[model samples]
Target: MTLTAADVPLKRPTVLVADDEVALTDSIAVWLSDSYRVRTAYDGHEALREFGPSVDIVLLDRHMPGLSGEHVMARLNEMSANPQAALLTATSTDDFRSEVDELGFDAYLTKPISKTELLGVVSDLAAAASESAQH
Candidate 1:
């Protein structure tokens, strides 16, 4: 039997959640696992280790130890992975908006984000990624 696109299962988009807060990282992972392939990293180094071309979205905490989210993002850019990244941070500085833009983040969300908000952003990013991939 010839398998058409409809006959094959579609691959779920991968989301990488990186935060120094262990609880937050695990919780976000659990929340996203139902809809997307979720990968959790407790630090910036771990985040880079888990990241690759397969990642469609990245939810990164801006203030991680050893290597900040900005550093990770820069490195990811160097690696040529075209994932949509969101900065999930507690920093709400006046210049944060410009910083996020300058640093190349697709979105910036200040923490204590609700599950709804997180899911919505991920869903939107995933959809955009899918659309871009088709082109």
Candidate 2:
């Protein structure tokens, strides 16, 4: 089926989610389908390959097979228009939070994140993206 403008989540805000967990990727993609143009990548290499450098946001995991979350965030920051990213990890650490933020992820959501929180965050990001577009 072709996607209409109304079908696109966050309007023009395309989001990329890169993680090694297939289940997590599928679940997130399903949850976010109604509101965002969501894409998934199983690893950092795939993330780099698939993610538009101009993508609006990314939900990245802290650990993966080859390239760590830190590494992906590092590379993203080097882009001219760095996409906003959030860390999703089952294990929460203050040190990790510090490190993730240093890489400029917009937020760090602990894993097992609720559907409500995910929707809410996406809503906020969409609004932010809209406002930015107006300016």
Q: Judged by lDDT, which candidate is best?
A: 1
Number of the top TM-score candidate: 1
For candidate 2, the 10 contiguous residues with the lowest summed lDDT are 5-14
Model 1 lDDT per residue over 1-135, tens place: 799999755989999999999999999999998889988999999999999778999998999988998889988888877788899888684676776677678877788989999989888898889998999
Question: What residue runs in model 1 are displaced by over 4 Å at the alpha carbon?
Answer: 1-9
Lowest-scoring 10 consecutive residues by lDDT in candidate 1?
A: 91-100
What TM-score goes with each of the models?
0.90, 0.84
Clashing pairs in 1: none
User: In candidate 2, what are the lDDT values of residues 1-135, reduced to their tens digit?
Assistant: 999878754445788888899998888889998767788999988888877745778888888877877788888777655666688788866765676677887777788889899878867766676677677
RMSD of each: 3.0, 3.5
